[model samples]
Target: MRSSGDTRSNSLRNIGLIVRREYKNRVTQRSYIITTILFVLFSLVASCVPTVIQFFAARSNSQSHITIVNNAGTTADLSGDRLLQYFNSNLNGSTSNGAQIPGQQASQSKGTPHFALRVDTSTPISQLQKDVKDGKLDVLLVLDRTANKDVRFTYYTASASLSDTDLTQIQTTAGQLSVLDKSSRLGLSPTQTQNLLAPPVFNVVYTQKGSGNDSLISLAGGYFLGVIGTVLIFMAVYLYGMWVAGGVADEKGNRIMEILVNAATPFQLLWGKIIGIGAAGLTQMVCLVGAGIIGLLLQGPLSAVLQTGGTLFNLSYIHTSTTLLLLLLVYFILGFLLYSTLFAALGALVKRQDEVQNAVGPLTALCMVGYMASFIGGSVAPGATWFKIMSFVPFWTPTMMMMRVATNTVSSWEIALSIGILLVSIVICAWISARIYRIGILMYGQKPGLRQIVRLLRQ
Candidate 1:
């Protein structure tokens, strides 16, 4: 009365039960919980660390004191004096009590010397060295105009850790002074020379219409999303790939897989493990995403205090189309399943723990190749026929298609075509992996290649 179909169905149900048990065992384990918590904490800290640093940087900038020893010649109507004055004036709108001249009246209640420009004309060299050594000077600028055609500046800072922006501004000012001096000497008017010396005016050009909303911010946003997604995909692979491989190896090593095979076929057990580990990966990803959202929300005020002109935290880049997100979710799940199943089968072929890497070498290489190609495809040859063709291929499709979608370069038809090809490839890969699993899971003391696998599949 018992049919083969009914028996197969019952066997599948048994495999499902096994899968559920494995999923629950892993998900509820203390190690998994601790790892998930630590991962979330690390991601939160990493995300907010930049903002925290920027806040401290801004506060330090406001509170910072700069002692400027201008060793340039005096009554050479030293342009250094005018440059220092301009710097002090510019600092006014930036902080509470800004930069002040050496002899200027103190305006603030604290009387903290924000900055002081000391024009030292006494031998300039030894005086500068003494000032630097005495901690009386933070920076020493020697403006020389002796027999030289142009003004030359030699700067010295006592501390090795001087701010780059501050140094750049100092250099820019000196360069400006040098250019202006040269132009004045050559009889070119200040206004004409200033006009000529000013930076060129340029506008960004784009060939795509209706993509006017595309800005550096959005492009940067897309790149950020692409990087995060790719990294997450790789992380997921690392986490669950090892899980699949290790689980298979553990069962095989312990001779537990042999006993399980008496009750259910290897295909059933293989898929069960894949599903179980996939569930565990999803559970961890949920925790990570939740922590990220919480961190983004809570860290906003702290972020805005540090950055200029725009929001410190933004999730608008996550506002991708529903269809694309759905497709991505599907592809991610399928891709994980495809790779993890193969990882399990390959792992079953190995006897020792150390042999796992060697057994899975081809798969790892494939992943690396796909990842690298996907990265380069959109960046280097977005319009290339080969790149477009490869985007529809399942191996590289997840990263390539996702990037193209982010860059708004992928069309609806292309997405449809890629999805179709990916689904078909997934089916074929799953079948191949299932065949290998059936032969490999119970196999012991022997490693197999494509030839052995092909012979096993035929059998």
Candidate 2:
């Protein structure tokens, strides 16, 4: 006694209910709970790792001391006084230990430069090396400058890639000397040379109408945001697609799909599985991202300790914006839906899970191409014509568009156009997938080839 309208509404309601059940069932499972908890724990650990490192670093730094032997008097052109004063100035406001005299109480001289400097022009190279090897000196810098060329700065390290900051300081100081020497030959005084080298003299006048401030930093921020967004989208899509394929295969192998099909159409069943698995993937990501944020906030103490302790470590770099994050979440959900449908349809065509590896190869390759292209295109040519156009193609578009948004200010229209293209592509893909689902779900035994799928579509 129900009208067609009522029947349609009820059907839609059922689908919504199924989606809720799918999401809830996934979110409430023991595996889901465990996975989410592990993700959060991993994230926190990742974040706290730096802080932990820093704490140990500070402890080690308090116990350790080093000596600098500047025999070449290479730092003399900058300061005629002992090279240690220059070293102290460079290291001060930077290192934990203050300037250490041989018999000074370490506590009273805390934050004073700790390293002892022996400016012996007569120390034999052999003894200097011995001092370094004996741990009397942590590192040795033999700065031998040619009167008219690059300074022959030999840094003797028991380690490789001299702590980058220390290397940077050495390089900067050497570079300044080089410039001063060149300027002296050019008939300029030391003061004049310093004046010319004063930080690049140009003001960036940002002229955007509505945005508050358009610093290059903000542009860099956008670029970083875009990169993160692209990465997250790529990860979500890639992970969830596998989930869909695997979920379908799992149920099919267990013969649960047969039972589910008796109660619902292939489309409904496929959608439910996609929603369930997709929710699981997102939950995992959220936990990980939250942990990463907490980790970044605690990096300061850790970084300081590393600097003072002279340890080598690379910091994790992560950045994203609220808008970009929301966009990524939306894209992930929508992209997951689109890809899950395709994977489910493909799954239906295959009887065994082993066949999925071959079946999903093309799809996986396509995803990899898109993911790599996003990274490559970002660095490959910056604003290349091909990259810009590819940013509009659905497969490549999400990542490329994100790159554009992050590295530069892309127009709203450009973003809108790319989104529209993706939406249309998704609709078409979904339709095709739904058709494949209907035809392939009941299939058993022999697997259908691409040719058979094409012909079936024609039918």
Candidate 3:
């Protein structure tokens, strides 16, 4: 019998060899090479989508010139310049495709304005309407008062969509103007009118302390990153685990397992196959991630060169940290090991490659359950009690925990506990898989029943 030290060394050496072989084989395949290249390109392009859109938007935007026609002397109280400033404030705060630039005012205090505002009390109503119809004016606002002395606004646009932001802005401004006019007519002092128009002071208190006041974009980015992380984890596990099963089945069908078993222990073969294929998947994943990062870095330079002002597709909103990425790698490795071991064992039970899928059906279903649960929980509520509990489950831990991590909802202790459970679960799965693999690889006829497999394990 070999010494335990020698056996340990031999196992490690064999696992290393297997891992390298498997990785090389998978990566060297024409399909695998093409697929990896395509995915890398796709990820890079996808990351720059927001930047491309912003570039086009900056170029394509035609400043909508609005000419207001006041028939009832609505500007009698407020000067035309003040009215124009108010309208510009309401409209140019930001544009549809543009992100809000910090420290930039809507008045073009430092940046370009989106809307041009001017009043034309001198122009005849007929001429103004004609100008609007002729597309000389993007919008025409006709203002008057009703029998109740309330300001009446008539909005005209030749090509205004039902969901135009300008329409909403005009309506909001009209209401404010009507209030101001009424307040002025009440014979109130300027201070009283200003006080009446000012919003009431209201303070907000949080019941639960969060990760500070993240912007809407940041909050959305966190959610987006979480969903993407979960998806990547799921695909790597499911797709590569199938590769493990298919490979094992193919080897058994060709009677290569007999030769391989003689060269190495069943345990070594089992782990070697898992590690080998996992390395290949990891390589592809790394390329994809690196490409995405490269694309993100390129956005600023691209924006400058194209003169799109700046990258609106900023990833700064997503809280990507080294800890998060490391955790992602940890969970992926553990999750892949936990599932692929079972896939390997199941593959050994099959008589042929085609039978592998049928043999692994139950495991596939269980994996699907966890995948669907993670996606649903990630989208709906990543911090709910049920989601938290589910994250601790070995099957769902990787994806669900990452969702929590990305959203900054899970505590450090929880992450530790989840990873601990997953590691323990992987060891347990490997043990059971090793047992099944010892006997199953040699069996060439009909698959053994649960009772027979149990008896085999007992022996």
Candidate 4:
């Protein structure tokens, strides 16, 4: 019993040494440092995109010039000057006619005016159309009185892709002008017209448990978390899995594996390298996540500093629970382990660094399938039956389960079950990988096929 305990202790020490060597060697590399810094900078820049766009939009000098040509022969109570004044006043956050236009609120009209209006009753329709087409005018409005006691309007613009805001503003202004014209003809007071056109107050109530403000916040937060989590896991697994495979192949090519095997068992060497490389990856990820969190936390203050009321990153939108965060960490670790172990074994099968990629192709494809499934399942149908089924799958559980959890579409029991299955799968993978590594690391000449691997494992 004492000898067995000592043997176990020695084995652990060897594994720890390998882990330390792996972690230190990777973290100290210039390439690793540069890559991590670049990723962090990229994330920071991405988070500031909305703010940058808002700044440019606020500074843009493009303005829409609107010309109204009234072809109506009869005298109408509507004044084109009055309409222009109302539009400018509405754009400037005030009522020009001492009454609020329907759907035009002061709070909604806070942006800089992108429209300039002019009234020209004498300009020919052909001239106006030519002006619009020649880029001299942004929009041309032709108005005529109909026999049915209604006004007919024809609008012309140079391009179809003009700003929707400008179009909506024009439509709203025209509708209000039509209403005011009819009201004036009917001898209605301005106060009566304002009261008649006032919109009714509408309130919305959600009946579902996860449909409240908090729930909506949670959902949004979950979406961001899910997206970030999926991307990070996919990258970590892919990048570091290749690292493990490449490291193994390099050591094999250099005959370093023979020396390492003399010092420790194949299982110890395999696990030691995986854990070590995994720790390096984990360190890089932690730094990135930490940088992202700091950037998110500072987004509000940054927005304030820029005097842009709109924030690029809204932390309030991500309401991830403690349990969900813990689950994510767990899934990340297990998912890495699952992929890295397979990578290490595949690395043992190859004699040269060039063969590492080819050997790991099958595993890489599997990871991609899981990654795609997580995205499609989460975005297309989070609560779908197949999505739930895929979440329970070991290879897919890390991403798919996290997505469902983030969306609040998964139950605790289901999460626990998925995690349990994943743990079992990891154990199985470890055993199989260890067997493959023991045999593959010593083989030379021609690379063995799957059938040979199976036959060897059986032996």
Q: What does candidate 3's lDDT look like per residue over 246-346, in tens digits? A: 99999999999999998889999999999899989888998999999899888888777777776355667786778887888888888888999999988
lDDT of 1 by residue, 246-273 (tens): 8888888888887999987877788888
Whole-model Cα lDDT of every candidate shown, in order = 0.69, 0.65, 0.80, 0.81
Tens digit of per-residue lDDT, candidate 2, span 1-459: 999999778667666666776678777879778877887887778766756766676565432233444433433244334444555443442322222221222232334353444445577867878877776666676766565554466666454543645556556654654565456557775456556666665766544333345565555566666676787788877777876786677678778778877777776776667776777788778877877776666566556644444332333232345666666666667667667778887887888787777888888787778778777877656477778787787777767777866665356687778888888988888788878877776677688888999987787
Q: Tens digit of lDDT per residue, candidate 4, span 1-459? A: 579889999999999999999999999999999999997887777766677777677667477898878775332254566555655655545564434553444433444556777888777889989999999999988778889767777889887875667777667766776777678678787678888777676654323234334345566667779988898888888999999999999999999988999999999999999999999999889878887777767777777776665645755667677887898899999999988889999999998999998888888898898899998988888889999898888888898888887777877678889888988999999999999999889887699998998997897
Scored by lDDT, model 1 comes in at 0.69
Q: Which candidate model has the greater TM-score, 2 or 4?
A: 4
Instruction: List the candidate numbers ranked by TM-score, top first.
Output: 3, 4, 1, 2
Model 3 misplaced stretches (Cα beyond 4 Å): 74-76, 79-82, 85-90, 93-106, 109-113, 116-118, 130-136, 186-221, 310-315
Please give the distance, in angstroms, between residue 271's alpha carbon in candidate 2 and its true position after superposition.
2.7
Please give the distance, in angstroms, between residue 27's alpha carbon in candidate 3 and its true position after superposition: 1.5
Tell me which residue pairs clash in candidate 1.
Answer: none
